[model samples]
Target: MDTLRIQRMNMGSGLQNASGTDKAQPVGDLGVWHVPQYMPGYPTAATIWPRVVIIQCEGDVCPGYEVTPELGRGEYLFFLPTRK
Candidate 1:
């Protein structure tokens, strides 16, 4: 027998919404998948609150969109992960 759990994260509110292309609209289709987390050498804890996904679009108008003068090319996404 196998146990299954369903969890949904809405990326259309708070800080996420403030800086997203589709503030009023949600991105992608809603679906669920089975994922597993593994610990290598140490014990750790995980939480289920905030999750992020990357979104990228290309066009002539916004060819290689640059957010900052120093930063070249714009790779937009729902969440930016921190380096561990």
Candidate 2:
């Protein structure tokens, strides 16, 4: 059976290569899939929250949406792929 696996590693701001060389490594499987950002509006402006959906699995494995609570400021959420 084929499935999508999400693996996480601690970069620690010191990602190194096999030869111990300093290198900038990606945070996720695909090297930082998406970066969510927000900026507050002016005094008369309103706050805009962010909503993101990431399909971690291939084909129809994923549930097509997030099952966890909404993401807060600077917070991240991970979901497991669904199996038939």
Candidate 3:
């Protein structure tokens, strides 16, 4: 339920990424999958109030779309862009 809401928010948020694209949006239509703490490359143990998605997940640290330069490199949010 919350994940669905997040997907909607991701679309309506109308944000972009470093390359001037909405690629940070979720990769699933109705699912927002975050990196689990038990996962090998868990980015952070902080709260989930973040705006980001895995841009490239082939590394130890997944690069995410930084909603702002100051949000740091933590890519915790995951969802598919509803606009697509």
lDDT, candidate 1, residue 25? 26
Candidate 3 TM-score versus the reference: 0.21
Predictions ranked by lDDT, top down?
3, 2, 1
Pairs with backbone N, CA or C atoms under 3 Å apart (clashes), candidate 3: 26-79, 26-80
Q: How well is each residue in 25-69 modelled by candidate 3, as lDDT tens digits?
A: 234554454432212244675655544443433322233332444
* TM-score-better candidate, 1 vs 3: 3
Clashing pairs in 1: none
Q: Which candidate leads the pack in lDDT?
A: 3
> Which pairs clash inside model 2?
none
Q: How many clashes does each candidate structure show, in the order listed?
A: 0, 0, 2
Candidate 2 C-alpha lDDT tens digits along 1-84: 223333322321112122221222234563232221222222333454433444445452332232232343323323333334
Could you tell me how far off, in angstroms, the CA of residue 19 lies in candidate 3 after the best superposition?
A: 10
Please list the residue runs of candidate 3 whose C-alpha ends up more than 4 Å from where it truly belongs after superposition.
1-44, 48-75
Ordered list by TM-score, greatest first: 2, 3, 1
| Pick by TM-score: 1 or 2, better one | 2
The C-alpha RMSD of each candidate to the native structure, in angstroms, is: 17.0, 12.6, 12.4
**Would you list the C-alpha lDDT of every candidate in the order shown?**
0.24, 0.31, 0.34
